[model samples]
Target: MTTPLLTLDTVACTRGGVVLLENVSLNLLPGEARIVQGPNGSGKTTLLRTIAGLQPPSAGKLQAEDGAIAYAAHADGLKGTLTVAENLAFWASLFGTEDIETAMSAYSLLDLRNRHAGALSAGQKRRVGLARLLVTACPVWVLDEPTVSLDAASVELFADAIRQHLGRGGAALIATHIDLGLKAQVLDVAAFRPAHRSDGAFDEAFL
Candidate 1:
């Protein structure tokens, strides 16, 4: 069997006396993608955040073979005053690379290169955010609702980028409500939801 880029074994998401999910386990292998789907209150975003190292798992083991994660969540992670190309260039530079053209081309952002991030529409901003993943060159991606605010064509573009990323032996853990043509394996966070919370912190927000 191929080595897994990321591993989560019997992970539980608990906090402040609440149990959101339990007994969650998965192996993210190279070139593989996993779709995390659930209802509004389900812990989809929680799971992705846990895998991304943004949040610590309340229980169980988490490991990564590649030890890198490129994560994008609800926030677009863009500077409003900066242009599309500027944002990408900044991230690329931070990642120790200087080639921003490839990422812009992948997301069809060439036309918006001069456009300020805040001035662009939601879909345009989403494209820019998605493009940052490619610029990072990280082998694993953890995305939460990456398709939010994207139009049909833009979604298709994002899907193609994701396909190409996986084609390069990258792995992804995505939590999304809309389909992005990824052909990913399914992981429904609702399946691991606890019947009740012990600490009276029953509320959990969705991404």
Candidate 2:
């Protein structure tokens, strides 16, 4: 039996008291991925954040099957003072792992192992973030614009990594504008666009 990793039923997200997305429903299963695509203000980030537990959904229910999710945002979450190896090692430890070498080579970062994270460029730092995903074994990956600073080759490397993850029975939920080199179910946030109301009679403070 195939168990869904996550499920969102009539999910609605809001920012600044304004609805961004509403009535979104999706099922994500193991070895599967769903790519979120939409305009800049289409609430793509909000949807991913809401599922990642970083933000609260304005309405509807979100359920997770099992295991904690590994979230990698646009930020690298690196400590400038630490070395490339050190930063990844720290994250691995938190996830109950210590093998950093495997992640280092995922993005061709083995050579930069000893380099200070502060000295790496934006792209290098982005690779470091991608490596963090592999440093530990997580069932679900929630990525937002993960390939932003990566080059073509790096993007391919990331794609290959994602394939490997799916092959190992993992699932991913990604919000990206670029091609990730893998076919996935596409969700257009615009479909759930909120209806504009001008009456302004309801007060949200009550909720």
Candidate 3:
């Protein structure tokens, strides 16, 4: 049997001391993609954040290899003054990788390689940000609304990159509303939301 790259056993996700999701469990294996689906405030982002180690889970068991996950959130995580190539180079070096050629080519960033990230449009910046995933050399990807500022073409580019990553035995957990045209498994957060708030404290966090 193939070992799972990530596993969450009855995990609970919380934000600002409020439990948004409880008893959520899932597993990601090699060459698999799982899409998280939920309405606004369904704890999708919180779930991803917990899984990416950005925040601790409120409860339950979570397991994954250390330094095995590459996360891309709503923020582009770019240096305004650095050129696209320089940004990628910085990440590549940080992750012990030296190749940025394929990553740039995959996102059609060869043309914007010389431009500073701050000068690029929202979509352009998003493309460059997503491309960073390629250089991290991690086997697990955890993304939150990766297509936020991407256009149709750029979305296709990102989807193709993911497909290629899966082809190479990588796994992904994505949270997005639009379809990326991949045969990905889906998880709805509604199932994990508590049926009733026992404390009666108003839940205001954006889940």
Candidate 4:
């Protein structure tokens, strides 16, 4: 059996010291994608954040190799002054990979390479952000609403990139409401929410 790239065993997640979800567990294996779904306040983002090591889990065991995961959140993490190619080159340099062609091509950013990221529209910027994932060379992807500003065609482009990533033996854990046409397993995090919402249990915005 193939070992999972990430594993969580009865994990619990918290925000602002209030436990939101517990008994959460899953394995993210190579070539697999898992879609995380739930209501607005049910901790979907929290679970993804915990797996990405952005914050500590309140309880249980979570295991993965150090630096094996790449996380993409609402923010594009772009520098306004840098051109699209420069941004990808910078990220690739950070990961010790110099090839940005594939990343640029994956999101159809070849034409926008010379354009400053700040000059692009929201959807174009979002594409550039998603393209950075390919340059990172990480085996695991942790995404939160990656399609925020993407149009239908751009969404398909993103989906194709994910398929290619999976084909290369990478895995993904995504939090999204829209279907990207991948045969991914679904994890409904609502099942893990605490029965009673404490006064301290704030929305994910606080995270």
Off by over 4 Å in 4: 198-207
Scored by CA lDDT, what does every candidate get? 0.86, 0.88, 0.93, 0.92
lDDT per residue (tens digit) for residues 115-139 in model 1: 9999999888988999999999999
Q: Which ten residues in a row have the lowest lDDT in candidate 3?
A: 198-207
TM-score of every model versus the real structure? 0.92, 0.93, 0.95, 0.94
Q: Give per-residue lDDT, candidate 1, residue 80.
A: 97
Encode model 2's per-residue lDDT on 1-207: one tens digit a residue: 886888899999976567788899998888998899999988888889899888788899999844458888889899999999999999988999989998888889999999999999999999999899998678889999999988999999999999999999899999999888787989889888888832353465345
Task: Name the better of 1 and 2 by TM-score.
Answer: 2
Candidate 2 total steric clashes = 0
Of the candidates shown, which would achieve the greatest lDDT relative to the real structure? 3
TM-score between model 2 and native: 0.93
Instruction: For model 1, name the residue pairs that clash.
Output: none
| Tens digits of per-residue lDDT for model 4, 1-207 | 999999999999987767889999899999999999999978988888899898988789999998999999999999989999999999999999998999999899999999999999999999999999999999999999999989999999999999999999999999999999999999999899877766654574365
**What clash count goes with each model?**
0, 0, 0, 0
RMSD of 2: 2.0
* Candidate 3 residue spans exceeding 4 A from truth: 198-207
CA deviation > 4 Å runs, candidate 1: 200-207
